[model samples]
Target: MAENQGFIGSIVETVKTVFWALVIAGIFRTLFFQPFWIPSGSMKDTLLIGDFLFVNKMAYGYSYASCPAIRIERIGIDLGPDDFCGWFEDRDGRLFGSEPERGDIVVFRHPVTGRDFIKRLIGLPGDRIQMKDGLLHINDTPVEIEDAGIFAEVMAPQGPLGLRPQCANGAVGEGATCEKEKAIETLPNGVSHSILNIGRRSADNTGVFTVPADQFFFVGDNRDNSTDSRFPQAAGGVGFVDRKDLVGRADRVMFSSAGRSMLAFWTWRSDRYFKALE
Candidate 1:
């Protein structure tokens, strides 16, 4: 009887330990930081398709959007931030919130889709933004850009989505080199970062865009490949994102993998481990 009781006590302790561990993890993810995986190449060389980083939720303070959205298709569980913090959704601003800086890489929720998106904050509220002749213009003055050679990658499927990269060198056989023109772009705030250009398209030239109050403008680092503020939300683009939708800032890439699965240890890119973002 004593042996059976001991076995039962061990099972109870194990359950208790797991319950506490989950509680702690939930708190950490909700209040401090949240893990974000890059599933698209919109950010490109700056943030690759398989890069993994933690968003600093405390940086901009908590809000309805700060709550994590859990979606598990296999188990049929889908919960958004609004579902968990619906009361906070009606609030005007964030709790202890601060304004985001221009040129900062930010992760925000799509105003229409409620989906998370990571992009560089290009324009502040009431800022005039436009893309003229492939150059970024803020308040009628164009940002500086210097040629930075070429960015090349293998012409193969990337990430789990199996998305093929668009190349500046035009179409090539699989496994061939795919290239894009790279340049160092300096924002008005003096923040400099690399941008990849895959030739000109409609997004290269756009009329002036006046950002609305309490709204922010974002753009992808891969200039030609990005469908950012330059396009309207009705056109399937991320129009002006609201301030309340801001999630957090991604400071560094904790890990990166080139393979379809992150568990593919051999596909890990050791050079990007803990690499600080500019």
Candidate 2:
């Protein structure tokens, strides 16, 4: 009887430990924060592949993951990736406190594939958004573009860098290129970034859609590479993010994998560290 009781006690303790761990993980995954990885070049020059981002689940509050099933109640729902990614749950009833603002970088779930994506907010509801000659126009206002010199992508004839070049100075992420093959465009909002407008390589998208209520229109900073609302939702895009599906407002890029990882310490890039998701 004593041995049996001891065995039972051990089992109970293990169960308790597991329960607490799961509860903590669930809470972290649902209410406070969640982790995401960049898997595509759709948002290149902004977010590279292998970059990990911490999604602020609290930003869009009342996470749909907290709800066990379809609930009749309305307030204080718990939403996790499951609901945000549209895996198990069909719809989450979370409402609005503040809508996604223009020029805000956001990570929303894809409408068609139900995958998470990150992009910049360009147009708001009731705004006329159009792309002309590869330039973005909001309400017919041409966003200002300033050329911050030319930007050239350098390949080490390999990955990010196989050997630290002689010109490698000013620490990592500070950039050491004296020449680039592209030009950087800074918008009127003081948001400056680079785009690879190689040739008249055809953006292949031209249309205008009204931003629906409680929804937002997004585009990638790497306008040419990003697969955003510019394309129809049928083309595996992050179409008009619904309020309920707004997983979180991207506050900051806590960290990012510098796209290339090598065993040689010199190959490790310290850039994109603690970068804000602007």
Candidate 3:
């Protein structure tokens, strides 16, 4: 009887340990940092398609309680089944957290779909943004950009979703190749990054966009391919994202793997491990 009781005690201790471990981990992820995987190449060359990174929640400052709620919903928990828990809760402007810089790579909840999105902050509150002949203009002044050269990618016939439009122009008799013009762009704040231009794409030209107070304007490094602040929410693009929708800033690439499964260790891109984002 004593032996059986000892075995039961061991099981209970193990369960308790695991329960506490999960609780601590959940708290850390919710209040401190969160891991995210790159599933697309929208920010390519800066953040690759398979790069995994941690977003520093403390970068801007502490967000409201809705931040935790958003994390919970991501794990399939239906907290409220109402507007309050749908990642659309209104957070006061006076709430904790500092404003994001003009060129920081930010992850936020999309205002329309409540989905998480990561992009480079182009315009801060009250900044005038525009695009002309594939160039970005801020406050009626053109952002500096220099010709970097060509960026090429291997594509299947079907091709990657957003990359197709650019690839279509660079297809060499068809079989599976794509290319785009690359440029080194400098934001007003002196943050320089790489941008992919797809010749004369539709988003390459647009009217001026005046960022509102308590909101931000963002865009992808892959200029022609990203559906960002340039498009409306109803058009499947993230419109002006509110300050409360901001999540955190991506700090570094922890590891990367091009394989579909984690077991495919051979596909790991070891060179990209621990790469810091600019």
Candidate 4:
């Protein structure tokens, strides 16, 4: 009976600890820092294929509830049929000091499915955004580009997600579909940054779209490889996101990984960690 009582006491303590730990995390993630993982190369060669990142939930503002579309969790509840009611209730509204600015790297909930997405802000309300021949234009003005040298491939030495460094023969299976070009982009505000253009095949390179009030346009640096505001994915609509869908601006690159290969640890580059996004 004594031994049994000891085991039960340990189990009870463990459960209580776990419960409180989760409670604290829920409070933090809901109103403070939230973690995110990159699962695709859609944002490469900037974000790469396997970068684990933390999205600042409070960078735009803190919340005690949830964004409307996602509401993946409410307070501390996991999303489920029974949790839907809470999702709509007690939504943690924004605590922003100001609206998101142009050129701010942002994390936003996909308007189509309420999923989170990180992209560069390119257009704002009352702006005319058009893609011409693989170039971005805003308000009938073309975004200027200055030639920058090719981006050197950086190697990732270690991470839970093993990514091999970029190489001539790196396992980017769809290499044929990607094109790399180096350029310095200057937005209207003179916010300039180096950009890698994947190819000139982006579907966005043809038409004009007017950003609606309280909406913004965004794109990935990988151009053709990104399915951003260009395609009509059933899960996410094509082009433009409302201010409400935007969660927070991407402040920095945090860290990037090569890909899924253990032999490539030597390929890791230490210089790129925590680099500013733009």
The clash numbers for all candidates, in the given order, read: 0, 11, 0, 13
lDDT tens digits by residue: candidate 1, 53-86: 9999988888899987899978999888998887
For model 3, residues 113-187, the per-residue Cα lDDT tens digits are 666788999999899999999889999999999999888765532212323335535546544557778889999
Q: Write the per-residue lDDT of candidate 2 for residues 1-278, one digit (tens) a residue.
A: 99999999999999999999988886666666777666655555566555667777665555343222222335865443565444534654564345556766677766656456778777776777777777777777767765654434443332333322111122334344523224455554566665544333355336666787767788876565667887777666666776655666666555555435535455444676677654
lDDT at 19, model 1: 100
Candidate 2 or 3, higher TM-score?
Answer: 3
Off by over 4 Å in 4: 62-93, 152-179, 202-204, 233-237, 261-269
Candidate 1 vs candidate 3, TM-score winner = 1
Question: Who is ahead in TM-score, 1 or 2?
Answer: 1
Candidate 1 weakest ten by summed lDDT: 90-99
Q: Which stretches of candidate 1 lie over 4 Å from their true place?
A: 1-4
- Rank the candidate models, highest lDDT first: 1, 3, 4, 2
- Kindly list the per-residue Cα lDDT of model 4 for residues 108-133, writing each as its tens digit: 76665556787788888988888888
> Which whole-number lDDT from 0 to 100 does residue 245 have in model 3?
76
User: Of the candidates shown, which would achieve the greatest lDDT relative to the real structure?
Assistant: 1
TM-score per candidate, in order? 0.96, 0.71, 0.86, 0.76
CA lDDT of 267 in candidate 4? 44
